[model samples]
Target: DTAVSQTPKYLVTQMGNDKSIKCEQNLGHDTMYWYKQDSKKFLKIMFSYNNKELIINETVPNRFSPKSPDKAHLNLHINSLELGDSAVYFCASSQGGQGGDTQYFGPGTRLTVL
Candidate 1:
């Protein structure tokens, strides 16, 4: 009975390889987001989707992509993974833009590139 869940909590790979992380939520939220936490512990929003349409897109590389199958699930896919991509990826969701609504985050998927 998890509110949010991310697959392969730990990911280890080499540079130039492709990988993906899956996320799901049972909170019945309409907005989902992807965030990356760097080694310095800087949390930055990468993408946000509402009803399967992209609502927010930060200055992320083209190698990164996000897909929302439904309002309850959002998956992230990365191509040509680079060392710079080694970071903790988080999946979060909110109940829409409800006046500074707080988002719930998953445990996080730690990607380590060699």
Candidate 2:
């Protein structure tokens, strides 16, 4: 079974549109995170949720929002998507949100904004 999974493996939309990516983890982890990888492959942390509470929220545009309905699910909703939003979004989970804890990553959702 896949420990972590995301819906819509590929997403293509026009600028100014809105979209959402859903993520779920079956590993029973308490902490979940959202990371964005740009075309150059530079990964940056966007948001982190622990036990359904917002923990670490990086400096991202207000257009980007992370919602956690429960411990097992974290969803990313983007509003007014722009060209810069084109990238691969990854969902990850760790046991305690510690630096040394191993993180399990989803396949990633590739978003392309035209």
On lDDT, the leading prediction is 2
Worst 10 residues of 1 by lDDT: 93-102
Clash pairs for candidate 2: none
True-structure lDDT of candidate 2: 0.97
What is the lDDT, from 0 to 100, of the residue 106 in candidate 1?
98
Query: TM-score, each model?
Result: 0.97, 0.98
Give the per-residue lDDT of model 1 (tens digit) for 1-114. 999899989999999999999999999989999999999999999999988889989999989999998989999999999999999999999989457988999999999999
Model 1 lDDT at residue 62: 85
